[model samples]
Target chain A: MSYAALDLVMLGAAALIALVAVVFGRARVSWAAAGLALAVLLVATGVFDNLMIAVGLFHYAPHSVLGVAVGRAPLEDFAYPLATALMLPVVWEAVGRWQPADVRTVIASSRPISWVNTAYPFAAAYLLSTTNISVTFVVGTLFFLVPYNLLMYGINDVFDYESDLRNPRKGGVEGAVLPKRLHRPVILAATLSTLPGMLYLLAVGSWLSGLLLVLCVLGVLIYSTPPLRTKERPVADSITSSLHFVGPAIVGLALGDAAWTPQLLALLAAFFLWGYASHAFGAVQDVLADRAAGISSTATVWGARVTARIAIVAYALAGVAVLLSGWPGPLAAILVIPYLLVVAPHWNVTDERSPEANRGWKWFLWLNQLTGFGVTLLLIWWALGR
Target chain B: MPGVYLALLLITLGCMVILDWRYRLFFWRGPVRAAATLILGVVFLGVWDALGIGLGIFFRGDSPLLAGLTLAPEFPVEEVFFLVLLCYLTMNLYVAATRLLSRRGGVGGDGGNPS
Candidate 1:
């Protein structure tokens, strides 16, 4: 599986620099700082996705080869990291350089080079292609995922208008808000982008794939705009947001023409756990804004303290699901147990309004990522037949 | 198979229209937002559809509610129908849960207080 020897070294360098950038500020350093950050970014994504694919979690046709095939991993998977590094910084820069203060500001402003915004999600999907690549996958991405994300971000901005006005830094007002008028245009863009993919699927006689695309388009529309503005409500908001995370991975079932297996089910379960944990914990940060906006998020309804607890439990569940997927050994499982028991139990009790919960959630989120990585390694090992 | 497809289409359309009507006629929120909600319903269905295909959970066997679109041996048109209908109901239930909790001013300080 040791493909792309040079690429691996570059990725290592990128990771090292990213560590420095995180410690200091990226702005304080040169473009080399951002360059280094970008380098390892896509590599990390690709390696992970590639490992997942090789382990029967999913599969992807290699667009390129780097001469390493441990079971079925290709050298091109390394490019995913490079792509991520590039796209992430692009988005970071775009949001910082071109964002407006409000929806009106966004609508009125004539920003140059705004198309760069599309790169991140595209890269996200493309990196995802390390797992599965089909016309349906692309359609699910451009039309459904990207549009839904933009709309969700816009609606979140709209709802948080007042809170955002009060706390500019935290709301992180760096992107243009999708104004009411732009709603249809965004949807139209999403819908139109899927046409080629859809047509390809139709021609291939993959009617189910085409149907998935149409349905995904419909899903994004309902979540963002109006009478259903589901995000205005609590649990629905969480579930809708979760679809964004899990929906893309749905291609797993179609990959390599395999049936849905227990391992895939475990991955989906992990997806749900992560989704719930992210929402329950993430909502903690926005309780005040969500409340002011007439939104009933879990953080608002359950209280941040309870929400935090739920997040911990959800995180724990995700960890367990990963463990049961026959990857990480009992030790890795044991490693996370203490944190789940000790740290998570007291995350938000004393100061619901304090940033302590966010800090803890961040830690736990890392644990989540670590578990994902560990599980990937384990799956690779499993594919190797122990 | 065709009958199953027709049934599923009807169920899905029915759910979409109902949810759309609720948002459009009852909520009085903007049309854009309402449309977004319906789209969301569809997105959930899509996710479920994908997962259903992937996980083999709750698939149709000898009997299906709808027919016509049997692209795969394991799936029917009604499968998509069930995905959409089930997802629509699930989303609505979540919305209701949020609403009910908000109305009670249950927890989380003034944040929980409904408008």
Candidate 2:
């Protein structure tokens, strides 16, 4: 069987497990939130994946696909996000069953808005590197889309519960102020959910791919966990957070057995810089909250003004880095302009007023969608040239 | 005439520098940081371009205005000026835009420490 077929079966199984978990789990369900998440997933996947396929960024073998199309995307493409939308809340709700009082809080901590962030990188990288569908691609995509995020953000919610309670930004879309009672269960859930996927991936992946996957998981753990909480280390915090995103792509490249070309390296470097700048800028909004909680970060250490300036510099450098990736790639350099503009107004924000940067952070989220569209256009151009 | 593109690029960069100094946009505020970012940016982009050229994704398009000078096979001298202009212009635009917005009370208006 082709990778697409295997991917569909695994996704179906995952969705079923999540559904059963939600049905049995005692945690209260929010039909509204679930419906909203599903709707967003449908629209995003239907639109973006269809466009990517239509433009030929990558294509599935005719026999490998199910022959069903939603716009230009194969029907199978929707399964990844659909499974994610279902599995995340189900996992959260199931875990929350252990601490009934914190059920609502755990559900909110899934950070549904950012779910696509992890999934897209893995799916896009894998698809781009390997023109053909394979089981490794499917398995890797499923892992990153759901369990990887659960381990990354779920563990984060548990570990940061104390500081989250004090941060005004918590208890909402930014994060969930997970209660103390739910901490152990949340950690248990994250570990339990990720272990199966990790083992499956390690068995299927080459040694290089397995090592990169391990590093990716380790990045997620160390960024939030104690003693080695890299998030508490100013500049290192940005680098680690950046790795959390870049690692998945690296793993995809390794699994695809793609040759390391200079242009590819340049693109990865540019992506890394963009990720670092994003994390650093995001920290600016939490400067006061972090300092108040005795949590050190790039923003708290350098002060918000300096941190914002540095973020701008990093963004600019990212744009320059992209310029060397060749024709259509150079066009992506323009994408950074929007991001630079979004953070530009907060240039002089002091620590006391750093929270005001949240306004820009909000815009940053939407800017990501816009920038994603721009990148898609460039990808389409590159594909057309090929 | 072969070096016309390079010469024009340098002249445009010079104009940008003049404007930046007159407006105290970037370098005037933090010369050290600005210089460091510029140098790092140029070096990184240069290496990236060299790599791309080496990998054969990039090739210098022939033109009468081209410098006809080679940094390496398939790599052009004009690329250096282009990278410098890109970094210089982006930094200047970023700084000038921020200063303008701050003055307009669009950002950081509460004495830089608004609680």
Candidate 3:
């Protein structure tokens, strides 16, 4: 019933799923790539999670945790990255066995660089609200960290493979140009991979949390999948993408049984706006490629220059929204300036030159690291009473 | 002396501007674009501070280094200077880093030459 027990169950289930999918799915699993990915994820999760815990941003109840500490994180924490490392490549291999190519493409689609984007929000919200490491917290964090990303990006790679083929930005860290035959298996894998975590989460969470979780999954699904593909719907695309990142935090807060305080609402609003700006700005770079492939995105529909302007406005609004969170939250508004500065140079970038915005987009990636550090400091300050 | 923190921040901002001017570190090499970027950044951050003040998350710290002048309840005048400095510093660093990488011929579509 405790988090430690649930952690063990989920870990076993994830490993089992990965094993069965790889074995019976008739996929070629590269031990070297899988091993490297697992090592890297483990080290990253250990370092970042420990740093947050050390700063008193949150803490784990000793009994609920497995008492096996790697730095400050419990042994159960490794299960997330480990499960992801195991599951994704096998899924990729299973899905794309006809191609039988390098595992690098799968790694790229997994978006290791942005794993913390989903994981951090869930962990922070759940920990801040509950202040206890419960089954819900563990399940939510693990789910967001791995299965959530698998579903989000796997489906993206599958459906967007055609556009990605035309996009110079694909086949690397930004995205993966998955082969055509892998499409069905990838979708199946995404669904199957997420099922166990989803079931466990629903079992442990309330109706409110379940609803948020469903919305989160729906956002992931509709954003990339055809027929209901929201990513091609202009402004709605940005809104849905934002939901993909912010939904988990809402689910965390709800599952933690946190009150709907004005401060919490403001934080969520700010977070949502930030997500919108990030996706919009990201869309700017893909305007040319998306259009070439007959896709309709916020950037493609509105044109690159206008989308960039919208992004700036959204980022500014996000900063303002965060200010409503009060004292140190006001200090956090300064963090938005970096994003503004990065995007400002491309203020008038044309569709022909939108690809140039990739330079700023690259900085945006590193900027997230810096901004995350700044937010961590602000969180510590808030936790320590200004 | 109460404004020493603000003074240091201004000095740092000045240093970054001089460096940028001398090195053309950021793409907004022209004074007009740079000034525009800075102003926009300050305004957005200021609005954010105002909202935080309204929501009651930001309170002026009890540091003697603060100028002790209130822009609003729990809002200090020094924050403006601090934010300006933050915006300027980030711009300079981003441009400088990008320039350095591109100069080394390591820039790729994703920004860094991953290969």
Task: Report, for every candidate in turn, its global Cα lDDT versus the true structure.
Answer: 0.45, 0.70, 0.71
Candidate 2 structure quality by residue, lDDT tens digits, A1-386: 44354555556555555655555444344444545556665786687666545533334556656677887777766655555444444543354345334544554565667767777777777877777665456657767876787788888887887788788877767777777766655665455456556755665568998999899999999989998999989899999998888898898888778789888888888999999999999999998888889889988988999999988889999999998886789889989998988988887888888888889889878898988788778876776787
Best by lDDT: 3
Model 1 lDDT at residue A35? 49
The DockQ figures for the candidates are: 0.01, 0.01, 0.01
Clashes of 1: 35
Q: Indicate whether candidate 1 or candidate 3 has the larger TM-score.
A: 3
Model 2 misplacement above 4 A: A1-104, B1-115
Instruction: Look at candidate 2 and tell me the lDDT of residue A141.
Output: 79
- Give one digit per residue, the lDDT tens place, for model 1 in A1-386: 12243345334433443343233222122234334444434444455445444434323323323456544455544443352342223222222222234323433221212222232223343333344454344443444334444444544445444455554334222344444444333333233233333333333334554464445445545565667766556677667666655554453233223345675567567666766676667677666655665666667776777777777887688778756554433334554564476446556563337345556555654565555556456545554664
- Order candidates by TM-score, high to low: 3, 2, 1
Candidate 3 lDDT for residue A379: 73
**lDDT per residue as tens, model 3, A16-132:** 656666655665555554565566556766886586455443344455555788877777656655655555455434543433243344445668777889988898888877877
User: For residues B1-115, what per-residue lDDT tens digits would candidate 1 score against the true structure?
Assistant: 3373455458656765686466432123233333333343344334333433433322344433334356454555554554344333433333343344445664311122222
Instruction: Output the lDDT of residue A51, model 2.
Output: 52
The weakest ten consecutive residues by lDDT in model 3 chain A span: A95-104
Clashing pairs in 3: A323-B51, A323-B52, A324-B52, A326-B56, A326-B57, A326-B58, A327-B57, A327-B58, A327-B59
Task: Give all TM-scores, in the order shown.
Answer: 0.44, 0.58, 0.59
In the predicted model 2, the residue pairs found to clash are: none
